[model samples]
Target chain A: MSTSEGGDSPGEAGGGPDGTGDSGGLRTTLTRTRAATALTLRRRDSLSVVTGVTVIYLLGYLWAVGDLAPGFGGYGLVLAADPLGGLLRTTSGPLSFAPVALVRAGPLAYEASLNTLVGLGLALLVGLNLGLTYLTRKQPAACGLRSSTGVLAGVPALLSGTACCGPVVLVALGLQASGVILTAFQVLLPAAVLVLVGSLVAVGRQVRPEAMAAASGSGARGSDNRE
Target chain B: MPRLTRRRTLASLASLGAAALAGCTTDANTGGGGGTVPAADDRLPLPIEPPALRDAAVSGGPGKDGIPSIDEPSFVAPAEVDFLADGDPVFGVARDGVTKAYPQSILAQHEIVNDELAGDPVSVTYCPLTGTVLGFDRGATSFGVSGRLVNDNLIMYDRATETWWPQILATAVPGPWNAEPETRSLREFRLVWTTWERWRGQHPETRVLSRDTGSPRNYARDPYGDYNPREGYYAGGAPLFPPLREDDRYGPKRVVMGARAPEGAVAFLKDGLREAGLLSGQLGDVPVLAVHDPRYDTGYVYRNPDELAYESVDEGVEGPAGITYAPDRLPLDRIHTFDAMWFAWAGFYPETDVYE
Candidate 1:
């Protein structure tokens, strides 16, 4: 009955006795993920990895969607007549919300859009995955699993930020856009979130808590024990 | 005083062009449908019916007012512009003693700019997909991008009537907001498609559209592609959308000097005009001439009913009594022409007579 937020105990979070049942495995995955994420944030090296990747990915996302780019040198701010109303409006392509404000710093201008928040969410997921990957790699005892999903999943999230005319990649690759391709483009953002979450769960479930605690020179909580 | 002199000269030329093309006008009224947007007296030839064109309209990734029009466009002196490169394309317009240049880079982001030229309201529109920049008299109302495209051209809707006006067609087409509206063409003026260096060189005192377009967009980054070096979508072989009619005579992205009237539509290959300096073509049964302007690297189409043998000379074009006139100002009646990508012109005007 304990949802993902409060249920860090392996037995309660894992629904079935075997922990391999479909529902049980998902719960176990969630419990392990929370513990692993806490460890990631608590450790200096893993936290650094998360911070660096998130910032880089966010900036790259902004640049790809063209919300951030080099501009004529000037400093100014422009707010749309109706910022709140504009937030719900889409621009350029699907899921690409209209920018409500323009902020210009010398040599650079950025359009403030809801997509930035979307990108931030994706970036955090990607960064967490990478941080988990780092923890697994740095301490072999922590987990025997390794994954490149963090990097791979980040690609679609970046492409999901299509520009005003069409998909920026399509334009760059000189590929003709068809109905099927555009439809596929529309699902990219959601697809990325699903992939990142699945990858994170897959990565987290492998982290043996007792081994991770030993690796980090910390005490393992009885609730976090998976064995 | 010199600016005033040049403005008067441009006004005179515009008047002469309108008067000369008046022969193409008839009793046909592309009705304004009681709209504030001014309707042209002559009904331009539409490839398809108004309702059908409306049916063919497809969403270009935005909704009404999605690609916001610069309602209160601000401009700066050419010297104050640092965002534009020398070769960046700019749409230069001169009317009522005012000269202004709208950079393609900036307009690429915002398709429509509702601004004033010497107290007269006008909309400067650019379609990145079709590579067309058109200027229309807005009358008392302004225009906005409908975020819908027909034949890969920007569909502008008037604020007053909300009727769809495709940039290439310049004619009213029924839209979702106001179906069954009048089928009328707009009063269009020429927006010279020239490079920033060329436009600035010709009009030294010209006001350049500043990066201070109230809406915050990365003006330096063209979502469609680059124009100065011609890359990405601008240089692509295939159009983003299928054309209404397909003609393989020229590449889809090839730029052509296109002019249409009630009589018919005609196009001259821009490169061919540049090379030959002068080319003759036909709009339906009437004879027309395309004179290349070396100053701005643009072409002007004129109605030459007499088949006048005017040759391109160093001064401009030599005509009656061997006196030379500017390429933009020939003795013959001028047809309102603007540059368009070949596919757009052919798609919108399938019967167009092309001079390559």
Candidate 2:
């Protein structure tokens, strides 16, 4: 049962019943592979969770921004006369489904549009961070990622801050994401517990020699797992 | 799964309920209390006692009109007139002819006077609401300056004793056009006389005439009479045998009416008119006399002490709102008062109608 680095070679410790290393180093690599596999799965799961959560957070943030639009003096007339008007006009085609034109029509419309955009942006950022935490039990790692993402998201947030609540939502979403990811696991005690329990169960199943053997027996399990 | 713990389940339910309750409570209360508060009535300081008819004996033969006459009525004598010392007299007199016989003793005490005389632009005026009789000149300017200019429509006159009586312009003498026609010619000058008894109701000061009264005669004289040739002369501009100098004080000077009076004097005048049966129903659609004095033109009609109501007009070409008088289109039939102190005998012939 000789093992090869990178765990791709066959005939490692406790290899599959074929006697040839056709199963690769899966069995012998189970110990180290479990952690690595679990981490890879977690990262992928985090990406999906983050993307979904970010979308939801962005939606909420945009809604909040729109709700607070009128108070910020971002009426349609003001926006149209503003320097950003041209930029907004250019982007209007892409956001045609959104009520961007309606927003530019009147103060209330502008506020509503801004709020929606901000809410959607915030939801996306927050949702992504939450999804990431759900996928990976490493909250510290998620937090570091959130901080870096926040700096990137902050640029848009600042630009839109003066623009009817849109930027505010972005900033809020970024802040929420950073808060969720950077804070200690105990800080998000409930969510951290859920992620820890889920990851443990998943990794436990993967580390099992019998389960690994079964999983490799038909490559179908691996494919299914990947999907 | 084993049986769930009751305590843990109950705790979880409580926490969930608390969170829901927290979200529901967001609004708070904000504003002040409600109560009734009365306004304060501040009185101007003057040395004179309020005006009143003396209870003493009435002397001297009655004049041509049968009203008791006081000869050589001294208005403001050196010994009698004391602006600081005397309690002013506020008295009423009916205009019989060209001569206005003011009980000098009454005027001497009060020093200030408020009266309604037949003149163009019948005015209700205050002479010294500010305690100073600073003359205003309305000569070549827009609003012709003539007749009487008083401060706050309160008049004070001292007759014999130095004590002056403050006459308050309480109510306006209803003009001919007012709804109450019967009360039009009523001669009872509607004014508020602040008596000692009445004074004591609000103030706890002694009711006595001070001996230090004075007058601001040095102030510029109201120059309206200077522009008019007939004010100080005989009838129809016939210069009397003796050409009168501008300083010849013998003739009719622009007399000030309704200057300063005691506090609430205006209210008292209203009540007096009601008691005298002078005011009836509502004041009719009387055309307001709007005077535009450019010198002091703050774009509003200066409320005549005798005027019941007033509002300021704008200065520019727009003129003012509710101004029914147009100098170019002078309506003769309408008996209108000029914003200036002079009264316009609207329908009366300008040649025969004698006005001071």
Fnat of all models, as shown: 0.65, 0.00
Quote the positional error of residue B287 for candidate 2 in Å: 23
Error of 1 at B156 (Å): 1.1
Clash counts per candidate, in order, are: 0, 111
| Candidate 1 C-alpha lDDT tens digits along B48-69 | 7678888888877677887888
How is the predicted docking of candidate 2 categorized under the CAPRI scheme? incorrect
**Evaluated with lDDT, which candidate comes out highest?**
1
Q: Assess each prediction's global lDDT (C-alpha) against the native.
A: 0.78, 0.24
Provide the lowest-lDDT 10-residue window in model 2 chain B.
B342-351
Query: DockQ of every model listed?
Result: 0.48, 0.00
For model 2 the local lDDT of residue A56 reads 48
